[model samples]
Target: MDDITEINTKENRQLLYKYLIKMYGKEKAKELMFKHKDNLFGNNSLAYSLGKRSIVFYCLYFLQDYFVPKDDNTVRDLAPVHYDIWRELEDIFIHHTHDKQQFILPRGCAKTSIIDMALSCWLHCYRESIYTVVLANRELDAINFVEQTKIALQTPYIKNTFGELVQPRKRTVNKLELELDNDTKIQAYSSGSSVRGTSYTSSKGKNRVTCFIADDYISEADILSDESKEKKYIKWQKEVEEAGDDPVYRNGKLIKSGTKFIVLGTPLAKGDFIDSIKNDPEYKVFHKSVVPFDPDEYFENHTYWQKFKEIFFDNKRENPLQDAKEYYEANKEYMAFETIWEKYSHFELAKKYFNKKLVFMQELMCDVDNVGDSWFKSNRTMPMKEIENHTFIKTMLTIDTAGVKNKDAKRSDYFAFVVGSLADNDFKYVRQAHLRKFKEFDEYIKHVISLLKENEDITHVYIEKNTYNGLDVDAIKSEMVKHSELMKRDITFINEMQRKNKDDKISTIVDAVNNGRIIFCEERVEQSFLDQVMSFAGQRFSLHDDAADCLSEFANRIDEIEIMKNITTIPRGWLF
Candidate 1:
């Protein structure tokens, strides 16, 4: 026997058991090393047996040899996130439960390597008498997945470890199918292919498709065009859903219950096929973005960050590449704390990093509104250079409260408020805005009072009466009375009750923004406000429209406020 085989013998196993007992307690060590004795030490060596337990460990040790050589002849390290996802999928597959899973990772996060290669190898080696179907947007992609799986299976590590268990009956890349010795099969099919009518059958007369994995079902090009998106959605509903639900038969007899469907893709658009499945109650969505740290906290706390962002945008307009380099070099202190800068400090990291602002927000942060079809363009909104220079005729505050009073409710809408000053030219400059799910009514009241106290010029406060029977408005007024000593100044509270539909509210805000009537104060404004405005896609489609709704409430009243100002300014004789 070989040296490795000799080490895995009965004598060596007993010696290792004694060593493990010394290290860990006898019961703990026995549970760890000898729980699956037959599977671990029956035919395969200890290295193969232990490695096979974890997909991440197996890939790192065994599959590293099979990785396609880089330009420098070095293999890339698998990211930590990949390991996390592999373990999650491993648990699901082992339980044999019909559960739907979705992974929303960024591009180049190795969704293909982890799913098509590592997971496939693990499944083929461990699980037997099961069939898996791989689907993609195009036939070529599906074929590629199968090709990669075959390569992974052919690797010396996999061949040596599970040699007898999963011998290949048929392996053809072009055919997009593989048959194993244990009567298990894997097939690849395109999204629009004829998969609904077809059934995968094993040598044991089992004709059940156990697992279905759909990867990159929606392409970037498909998301941009409306017609293509519609067509893809139709194709997904008809073909993809049908194939996932198709019955599994054995020897002309119905055998399996249901297939476990796993959908993996980056969120390229809002209402894509992946998104459709995400909304479905059957699927459990595990959406993860590449955000290294929370940008919201920084943007909210740092006064100069918003101004810095405005400068970055201005510089990007002229030359995105050169300007980013210059900005990074000039503001090294400011950029040093950012996660992107910590990893990629150089300018030539990639051309895409030059457009870091959009890439970071869209790709890493997974800001669906910024990446997909947005109603309001983020670039169109200009920042104020000097708030002091602008002359204000009237200043107003608009508040939109979530109807629910429960502090612990997870799905409760945010309490959003916008403070703006209407200039002499009727152009309303947004001084500041706040949007947050308040924990209590006291907290919400405190924030509102703070905003009013900070901006002494705020003459009118309009609270949208969309809550339970004007109780929220009455509560606010009652709270304001308690803080009258602190308020020190008279502030008129207006209960605006004429509720406009979501479409009208969005349209009103869009018109004001596009027509150059609503200007945002860059220094004082919150990033959440911009995100809400940019992501607002009318009432039905948006994730959160509270911020936009608050802004629109102010916009709708701008004309009325202007007219009231004009009437007050007119002479008494002229009025007579």
Candidate 2:
């Protein structure tokens, strides 16, 4: 269900039609009904038909029933953002401005249903463009848009206002394509599908594929790799833009504004297709996040946000989401955040997705700094002030080993290791961490032994039972045995197999970091380790997850190792 479009419908529409008949004669009454419909909102079809603003009038009058609500309590009205997009679309179809445009929208704003779907129907009804093509990342999504357009054309007001636009007998109406009565063909295609021969010949003239509406064309596959990203740009150049008549300019004036490429989507990735268009000079861009104000200023030192997160994310509370909604609705003005659309524009709705802040930012705010899902937040990991004199019951080293698979490969996974200790309280402290290439095994071992000496009470060394199994453990033992200083303490070596599901194994770290159970000493931990740990966008999307893997192993095994030691439950290393 959608938020009903808030319109001025205080006056009865059917009763007003009757009044129009009484004021004027029957013929003029019908004319006045067409002219002054739905309180008019200062619009009438008689005056609207003469000018280029037919799109707006049609939407206000014909699509009124579709948007306006029956409930008087629903305060969701059409805001300025809606009219701004309507005028921009009018500029494209009627006024002939820059043909290419992109609308970067917050997710819940209904401007898209007007700009992309309903406007396409108006274009077909007015016979504006001969051949129109709509596209999405998937063909089914494009078909969904086509379905909306088809439904709009058949609406009661639309059919009553403008007679049957669908072809009388031989209408080619289906899921993928629609042929209007005026011989205007509108087809839908997936992003990379063929739209080469998109042209139509009418009695007036032959027009190439002129109106191209691309709505949410960037998919996960499009932004997967560099080659796929390039292919998206190439598709726009060859299929959408190049397939139409090239716009001709004579004297700094656009003589022919050829094709319209309007993209409607929220930014998913940093340099995806919509972002690339935003940087280009030839196209016009309209970007609106959830609110019109600067996000930084609104969220800086936000007082109510923490309480909101606690209440919304609480699983024990019954109807926590509804209770959270009521709380926000009462105190929203005190927060003083203004959404573009009043209620439906994702104002306090971030509480619903507080756990996925990156998604909330990228989807609702169009801030693609961090693309999407983040398992571990870098800021959540606290840093200790000092760690020199702090004594630990037991310190263990976890090494994420990567064998030298191919020396000639452009890039190789790093051998990441983390040294962690269990304190007297239920807190695990990261003593040190570093990463290096697998080629320098000697250097890697030297660093490991050095860390061992630094953390002298190192009880055990654990390695994943993979590549560096048998001789590698022995080599480390030999190096430690050579040092007379390390001869006092006895160390255990274990080559253990890890769980196959990496994300499932690493799931505990999220709560551990968020709840302050784990701390990282910034002085000892390398920046590379922190970066890999934070940028691990779940399910192995990062270039190298060795550092994250090492941290996960270290965190999971801390309690088990303390149990093996049978350490006193009184102080540090009490199975933190």
Candidate 3:
């Protein structure tokens, strides 16, 4: 039974019809032909009865039956496994390559292998004299496509059919171009230094491409950049759309095969292309595990992969613990994977562990358009609440005016004030706080002083010197003094100099938090203040000296509250 000459000979047609009957049971195959009775036409009634629609069905049915392997070593049999997923992928490639799609996948899936098999099948099985190109982030990865395809073609059935194995040309590195007796050409390329500026069509020609496969097209460099990411994605979209139109003949198929245009890598942060593409509705998304597991309902009751080694590896191997240690030591990347698993696993374990859609949409998949522009780092574990309830005296109130004076800036943290006191052993603790919208410096200062005076613990008032570009501090201080005079209390004003090294300012703040000396009020303390405490790496300090600034000012003005050596315990809840 020959597909190429099934139309040419009546005897050959009979043989092909019998093959189809065996492939799809006679009743089912007959039902399909009967449904397409009007579309079938030819000199031979049975041959003519198989219409265009039936031809497609018959072709697919026969292709599956003739080529797919059923049992173990399916990849070697040159017979396609009748996977519903592979069928859907084929339909998508057949129909939608012209429309650009971005694919997103979790790590350790067989995306690359699937792409390799698809590229080979699309070009070789269909599309005569078609030019096909495969590309990846690097030349080495591109070469792997060629290697994998050669492996696919080396399947026992394919080798038996062709009577020879398809092997890579030794001289032409990073390229595996295969030409059957027909002129169809398959070639691969790495998207590294050699192919960066080179466009595929210019070298391969327009109307010649049957398919273009690109895996991991966007590099890490492009992922990190502002403009480069957009430019690279746009270029890939153009190439795919344009290449999809390059059929060997009109109305012929031009396939672009890959596991979608996956920007494959571990997600580093929020604003990456993988994150961006997962939001797209146009792309048909699928996630299959390189390691398989069951659905969600079934997932919860069992731990398969995690427990596999614990149960089997110890007894299976000579030494189980040593074997586990060796495996863990060999894969350092798994450490990072485990770390992410710990933080994100509660929401993502069902997803990555069991291949389920992450239940939490806001955490797993983010909306691209609604992505945040501003991010604040905060910690609630070692919360500001820890600092909220502490004793303090000789408190100094200090404020750092927001650098910008826009109305919105005024609405934001325009005037950030801290009421801090020097505790025992010279450790300064913040007692009160106020930061909010205000236009007038005197008015803002008045509100701050009024808040402090109500506390009645604050004694010395210190104001940051460089406010409103160093122009308004004097007027601000004078207004504070006038307000005190009206209140009929003589409050001392202290002016503190800013530190030259911002690190020094931060150290002064960190020392207070580290020493458990500063206490915060529950009313104004926040998680962000706590986050600053926890996130103090102590070494790589930058862009976080505001809270430290307030701390430094308090430390500069207040001295230790000295007491008799025998008087060890200070009275609790005493505001001096």
Candidate 4:
């Protein structure tokens, strides 16, 4: 449906029935409006600007005729999806001490258009904020936010209601700052930059920044590691956040109200910036995922939806929804999961990243971690106590080095090691130990030797020589000489040239687990190792594969795995 632009419509439909009833009596008007609702619109008026009760109505009314430039900048109406959130936010902003609030919404949920520009206008229009500050990741973003606010002030409805917020002669609209005629200053700055001078001396008195808005302050590209995330966290906390104090003024014996702090962004990962705010008890958060309910729960047939989706997006067809019109009318409930916006339903949006489950989960669902089918059955693995009585014929260790040339690099991948032994004639492999860490040459070899010494039955060791060009293995071999006095003599160290595809090789571990041949010692296994093995799906599917790859390497050599338990064992490390 075309956007309901005429405020007459927003104003009319709300009271059209009452007006019609006054003219044609209650029964007739009710019959016409209910049975033929499409023909009716609300009663026309600008009465929503009266008071706090009109907060929701006023914002929803202003959603149309936005002058802000966001592609095809024409009058657009707020979708039904916007009402609930806006109502809730308007209530909080108008009548509560929302000291720190967050709106962690999905990527294209119109958060900026609604909250940053429109809701901000609401605050300024109502004189809720004295000095408002917008903080962003980049200088351009900061400028853009402030620019949009200025543009909103220029809109017809805004001007008619608020009456020229900016002063004509004053430095009203600069690149990053605007001083309204009401002595209200709204400015923008890049996050982490110095905001020590945000305090302004207005004619009335001293003006401390009473509002802080962090909007898209942290993007996906900003978060690389926990350390990088912490850097941003510190900047946000120190500069952008601390710039605004609670009270705008202090009387001799009384106090004023506090700042209304707001944050808006989608979370990138489990321990990212948004999650940090969520964990803090002081901040109030409202999170809205793109898909409200699991689409597959209601719509079980993928092939059917794929057909309708294909037809809809073909564009070549005269009508996109024509082919599946009946089907959609019947099954739209599956897609109607109370999305934040009705323009894109759950099924409609899912097609954008249908194959990329991890991306879909992170971006659309706000899921810190994606949960899906794993290659191995994590529940089937036996604990350490269950396998204590088993006799071991051969033991070995496999290493998956997080490829790095510099051992001393501050940020490098971990070296993951897996130690497992084959028991008697049964194909079962019992894990003895697992370790993963960022270690230098000496420390790495020390752990390797400890794994060897801890599990004395280990007769063979294999380490994938990735990027290190066998240098890591060679370093360990050279370092083993130092520990030769403490180590047993028969252990053989082999530099494994990892020419095979890791994704293909990991299948062996899955097969071993499915056959009940691979067992995990819960007490001895490292948590990271367990996480890797359980979460790994294959190729680019998981974040880390160190521990899983080490076990997969062990499975690769399973066929000829043998080590002379008493003698130079024949059934030792197996050959793949």
Candidate 5:
């Protein structure tokens, strides 16, 4: 009986060894063989425990693979970059999801893809019916993003999960609506299109809103002007932001996703949401650059990653172009690659491309410094501290029209006009500030007329002949002519010739500001304007500070109260 039992035990051991050999291979199986050498080895041993764990792991992995399709485009299982952004958004989803926060990212980075996938997953997988509104600066951008998202969903892997569950359809050219099985639907709308007035009614329409994404609401050039474009941008931001109100929690999240609005573009030359965020104390902004830190390891691990860095040379200081070349030579790979070091390179780029001071405040760092060799300082631009409460008269207005770029939405300073006094140093609170950004040109014309009516103390109006491709100047004159027929007041629209250098004019104005001759409105005007004013580089104005430019030109063109020389010269000291 003992011999028969021994033979049966040997047979069982042989079968187990064969299975182990097949699973773990010969070498690993040999290691396991010793683990099971003891009579009690099967109960407790390193190899025995590892064998058990491996089996359990494989079983779980197999189950997950079977249930979850290989192409699950869900946010949770997105690519690494998408996953990182999703993680940032996940916190927002649970807490501040309803609050409108602007998101700015560069182009061609699959931002729309991630957003659409996230929305779809949030809706179908989580079974949450969300009222999501996706807006773009133009109808084309909005349509393209939505269509791409729909196509992504149609991928074989994505279809396997929620294909029959939710049907993605393009109800219109500018509208993409998806119907879910649970009677929950998502409707997409474009800000540039007529969808602004579209009804937001729902079955349970008790203030229903889940997400709002405004992608590339403004281009770089549009945001830098002091015309209607700036105004339109501000207005759209306010209206779209207010659209996401939820009576339930009274908390709705609004996201502005675009490269220009956030970062990855030239520093704003005019006032923008980015400027507002930097200036507003109540709004705590969390800005994270794409590659905020050294991607040495990441780049080393994945060499295909390409980075674009811009370097600048200050010709005023050293040979700027030469300095840049040498700098590039010393740090060739790092210079060409986007990394933590590239941010420093961006500072150089800002200095050379735009103005050093502008980039410093708007890009490299958030600290707004007034000290620099700027057009304002060189031109003796004055501060309100010196000119405040001075008796003066005869206010004139100058308009910088931007009608061409502002065709999509009128949220830009396309028509930036400054109303100030030429004789009276006492300018009435910087009133004639008009930013045009509405669907209709008539709205802008009316706004400008209203400004004119309010500031009745004005004697003359000067419009830049080339403002808005010169056509706008003509349009304004035509509009004024039409208004003359209706109103008894005689307001003449005169065009200014661009014979002199605007930079020299700007430089002269800068000298005035620095000499404490020209004063700015403390309450109404933003420090961003001042920062922009003081940071005006000698020539390449970049595109953000048009209002400041208008203010500078208006300030410079008007004769000073008195020629006060030698106020404060930059003390000469060290030459290293």
Candidate 6:
């Protein structure tokens, strides 16, 4: 069971025969056992039989020497999971059970090299007059697949084993076509190319496509662009799927069969072509995300793994399949690494890779829903009151001021204030947040003075300086002079100016919120204030950005405030 290569051995064949006998009765098992025995013989027909029966054996044994890494000439075996997937695909191909198959795998899992190139070569060499068409998002990608197929066929190990069987009669890079000595042909086409009337001719004078493989038909750029998504959807339906209409024929006579279509790629968007195909009844979907809901359980109880046990060992379990929802319910703890923490990591990767969250979800988890848009979710926030034990180092007040004559206007920028303590230089616990629209400059000053009186720990008041709403040093100082008796403590008022864009400022707060560096008071902070902060789109200006602006300002200036807290005292004669 450990060594996959052992399945091809003679001793395992006897064991397999007995298992088959127990499952399919004596007569059928004898016929199957004889076929297996015949396939093990050292002959050309035996080689064909082995290749036809097991794709894993064909790749690992027959094509092992040829499929070496270009840089080091080292042969790396496919992962056990990959072999299991290939075997299932082989069964579908040999039995002609499904007309379409969709394979969703991670980025570097070798779906293109193993299945698109090596398996295509095996099919061409083993089957007589087989026709195939390879398609991709771009012309260059299609050409690469065709070139890889040619390279696979021309390898010394393959050429020596099959000799003239795999030799190309005509290999044209311009046309992206490869015609084998056995009259098997493969052509590559881009997604939008005209493939309506395309057909391959066999030695027996039959013309049709036997197989169609589409790799990465959706690109990341296409998913990001709304215009491109619309056009690509139309092209996928009109051109790629319709290309399989090439009629099959046997012995120069028309047949009722058509080409078997296989669409392979990581899902890009929620309702892209891959999603459409999964919803349609025509295609048999085979989706394998790199990180499932429960990573440990997926490795043990996946449907493909169960299928592998059934096919190879004739072992069946009562419960063989577990969907994403069931796995999440059973193993909720394991899901956090992928769904929550990794999403923040993905945000960093998106900055580095210059891609979006859509690409990250699709490539890593095969998740279709776009997640990176909302920088902060409601559940990510923790209540400050929930902290059981913490030392409060310093209390600071950050303000985003708005000016309006009317104190009861509906459509005006809200004056936002955030009073929080820097606890242990790591956590920012918000004690209170005051958010209101259409407050006069005098009333706003009185309100801030009252807050400063109430919160005696507040030593610094950081006000966002702007030309509008009479928010300036002199205006605030004049109001402070009027209420000098209330401000018994020497409060340092800092005129903070933001030099960066609003989006960049919001991103700073996003990192703090995501890393659990900030906490809000459940009772003191208004629900409306939290709602505005959570719902603020980082990219565009929303209807209300006061709460988000205040939080971002606090996050941006917290370090500076810490540096000030280190200063014990200032000379009374020192001028500002």
Give the best candidate by TM-score: 2
Clashing pairs in 1: none
Candidate 3, residues 1-576, lDDT tens digits: the string is 123333334543444456448547888767755654432223223432332113233233323333334453343232122243344444545544433343343342344654445435444534422556666778777666776665565543233224233533422323555544333456776654333232323233543454555566655566444566666556655554344442233355444333233233333224454444544575555433222333323433444434433422222244544554455455434422322112233323432322212212222332223222211122112234554444444566676665444655422443556776664333445656544556655566567657655656565666666554445545545566666543564455565455454433444444334323344555565445444435443223233435545555565556632222235677877756
Would you estimate the TM-scores of all the predictions?
Answer: 0.52, 0.64, 0.41, 0.55, 0.40, 0.53
Candidate 4: residue 573 Cα off by (Å) = 67
Judged by lDDT, which candidate is best?
Answer: 2
- Which ranges in model 6 have alpha carbons more than 4 Å from their true place? 1-43, 66-77, 164-170, 173-175, 192-194, 200-208, 224-230, 246-256, 291-361, 369-375, 378-512, 517-530, 536-576
Candidate 3 C-alpha error for residue 379, in Å: 5.3
lDDT of 1 by residue, 1-576 (tens): 223453346643664455446546799658867664544334465445555545555665456564423365565545567667877775666544445788777666677877766766776676622778888879888878877787777755565556744344453224588776656678888876766655666556746566778888776656554566777767766765665545467997655546667788866556666666677787777766554656657554654444444444442254533564666677656644433212232333222322333444445555555333566754244456665477788888998888446655666688888898877654677888887776666777778878877888877888877574566656667777787654566667788575555544555466446434477777777887778787887555677788888888787775566324423476679967
lDDT tens per residue, model 6, 326-386: 4444544442334222213422332211213234455755776543356565323445556
Determine the C-alpha RMSD for candidate 4 after optimal superposition of all C-alphas.
Answer: 14.6
Model 5 misplaced stretches (Cα beyond 4 Å) = 1-84, 95-98, 104-129, 165-197, 200-208, 220-230, 233-238, 247-267, 277-284, 290-576
Better of 1 and 5 by lDDT: 1
- Which parts of model 3 are misplaced by more than 4 Å? 1-25, 28-82, 92-103, 125-129, 163-182, 193-207, 238-528, 531-576
Q: Comparing candidate 4 with candidate 5, which one achieves the higher lDDT?
A: 4
| TM-score result, candidate 6 | 0.53
**Each candidate: how many clashes?**
0, 3, 11, 20, 62, 0
Q: Pick the winner on lDDT between candidates 3 and 6.
A: 6
**What is the C-alpha lDDT profile of model 4 across 1-576, one tens digit per residue?**
212455335444555555456446889867766664542322222232232344555554444455222355654456655666676666566556467888888887777877788777777766677788888878998888888888777655555445577654775678888788767888888865677757856677788788888887886555655677787777777766777765444564325567777888888766678888877788887877776677545334566666665554432354545555656667766544466565565555654433234555567777765323576653235667666667776778888776435565544556778787776544445475464564356677677777776777777888876656777766766776777654446777777578765655675466445434467787787776777677887655666666777887775564466555455656546754
TM-score ranking of the models: 2, 4, 6, 1, 3, 5
